[model samples]
Target: MQKTFKLLLVILTYFSASSCDDLFEYHPNQIRLDSDERNLTATNLERLQKQQPGDTLRLIVMGDTQRFYDDAVDFVKSANSRFQDIDFVIHQGDISDFGMTQEHKWVQDILKDLKWPYLTVVGNHDLLANGSKVYQQMYGPLNYSFTYGHTKFVMVDTNGREYSFNGKVPDINWLAKELAPQQGEVWQQAIVVSHVPPYDADFDRKLEASYHHALAQSNMVSLSLFGHIHNWNTDYLYDNKILYHGTTTVKNRGFTYLKVWEGGYDIRRIAY
Candidate 1:
């Protein structure tokens, strides 16, 4: 009886120690991460590129997960179970509430369960002190683009307030170049995704005109997606033809489903 009791206690102690290893992190801002956790944007993009091509591009565009761990998990579950046909997922930013690397990791831990490849843009909160570095380390560049099917996704950083309204957060020049058709680029349309919409106060006022100008010049921009206010809003901001979609946070328990083809697209909201 004495030997059995000692063995049981040893087993319990070992399990407890192992469990708490991930519970208490070395630091909130620590950059510690496994090789598999780094450059998640690139990782998922590679996965997306390898999949069989389809005519219509179907994807989920959502954001502002922040500290909502439970909701994020449920969102993934609902997405996987209900939208098995989706090609990929888009997280609009604010992966961390306090801009802590740990918070980003926690959200990533939950988002990893998603059945489809996912990508993320940066938000104002994600641009906080040292947060940008952490975000870049975990995800790839702040402003980037990818093409799948008939659409080109322009994921850019538009968190202007985080840069003190410097009139450069949106990078209008880059946006123009990204939106325009490249010589061999076969995409029929462009979709812009960012954390802040151009009409928002958080976006740089000086660059708003230039930003819209870039989209208009492309002649192929289908829609603009944003997530920062934690509330869903949509309308044709400047031009009746260009629709801007603002998605609520994951804590609100909802997301947007986007389907696109050569000349047109559809947007739907799903609550789980």
Candidate 2:
């Protein structure tokens, strides 16, 4: 009887430890990550710079990976099947469906297997609970830019409704500044990326006019990329001044292929 009791106690202790390791959360806003997982946007940008993109930049744009683990795995495989032909990947957002850090980590684990580097924008679903905080810790700023090849890719956060239309989202002032040429920056064209497009109702309706005007003001700015729509779409909106490329969600097993050069660009949808 004594020996049996000791053995049972040992088994219970082991299981308790395992459970804690798997599901323990010290705080709802806690962010736990490995070194390689943190600041992924910055890391991937460094890798891209080293590759030295030519006059044309080829990319695989996809998003809305939230709660779609199986599909996400298949996406990496499909994306890798044509690995060498691609330069880098752009994940439009919704890395976590529930806006949990663990979910973000799981998604990153899958994405890390890709042959090329990748970047992400923050999605609306990612704003749930402490998701926004976790996203910043894991992926750097909500808005950032990287100059590559002959174009400057400006990533912005346009999920204004999530902020209750705070009147500051999609920051036209910042967009205008980033779109313009600076002393140290080098790029002939500007490409904006975000999770939500301004035409969508979820976007700040009040800023739609100003948003379109800002893009138009920068005559060099023509193409903007988005992913919240869950459908592959491209349009010449803003009175045919700017071209928008909206990509599909991962659950649909689809993405958009973009090849942009100095003067013009091309777009194609891929159903993987």
Candidate 3:
């Protein structure tokens, strides 16, 4: 009887320890950066200097990297080595599981090590509490647009309503004006980057309606890029356009590589 009791206690102790280990597993946040890390460097900036006209630009895209901070770091490092000649980077948001300040700092710390320019759009998890303010202060403005290689890249604030208004980013009015074609432009293509996609069921219905219409009407748009679904995917929204859905960092443990020429682009996933 004493031997039986002792064996039971040993089993219980072992199980308890295992449970604790599982409970204390790594939980990645935005601010948990490496101790030796600093922000982006001059060399990194130099690497992103504007490309000459007509050059084939290479950019990399990453899906939801909110959790798995170490995985995110590893992903970037692996991608850097493989895509040594990349021009720019774009993260599809959810850099944090809770959009907390610490999570943002952590991810940024890892990101600053990249030898290329990078951009991040907001994700659902990134808009939790005062996330927008933290994101703006740490990163930059939302709903901003830039041009590269005859391609117009629009970063829309899809989580605008997360604060108090509608999650309807890409302000229909502003986007309408931005999407308006400029005279003398030939063979223009646009890429829309957003956190929540128009087809996401949990997103605001009214906002989705307005934004979907706006995107469809944006005649120059060639692709809509999003990452909330956490899977490798592509959808044909229009005859001339396709929506590229990126996979989550935790799911596929990979990122997407993009090769863009003057008129078209090719994207593929690179797993670690």
Q: Best-fitting candidate, measured by TM-score?
A: 2
237 in model 1: Cα distance from truth in Å?
0.6
Candidate 2 lDDT by residue in tens digits, 21-109: 35678865568787887999989999988897877789999999999999999999998986567888999998888898888888999
As for model 1, its CA RMSD to the true structure in angstroms is: 3.1
Order of candidate numbers by TM-score, starting with the best: 2, 1, 3
TM-score of each: 0.91, 0.93, 0.75
Which of the predicted structures, 1 or 2, would earn the higher lDDT when compared with the native? 2
- Which ranges of candidate 2 are over 4 A from the true structure? 1-23, 27-29
Model 3, 1-272: lDDT tens digits are 99999999998898887745233435432333333322332233344555553567788888577767888788777877776787788888888887777676667778877777787777767777766666665665666676766777777766644645455454778776677777875437778888777666645656766776676687777677877777776777434455655555644787778877765778787778
RMSD of 2: 2.1
Error of 1 at 115 (Å): 0.5
lDDT of residue 207 for candidate 3: 74
Put down candidate 1 lDDT per residue, 1-272, tens digits, no spaces: 99999999998898787855376678777787777789999999999999976888888988898888888988989898898788999999988888888788788888888988999999888878788888889998989999888788999999888989988889998999888887987888899998988988989999888888888788988688999989899889898878898988999999999888888888898898
Q: List the residue pairs that clash in candidate 2.
A: none
Among the numbered candidates, top lDDT falls to: 2
Query: After superposition, which runs of candidate 1 have C-alpha atoms over 4 Å from their true positions?
Result: 1-24
Please, what is the whole-model Cα lDDT of each candidate in the order they appear?
A: 0.88, 0.89, 0.69
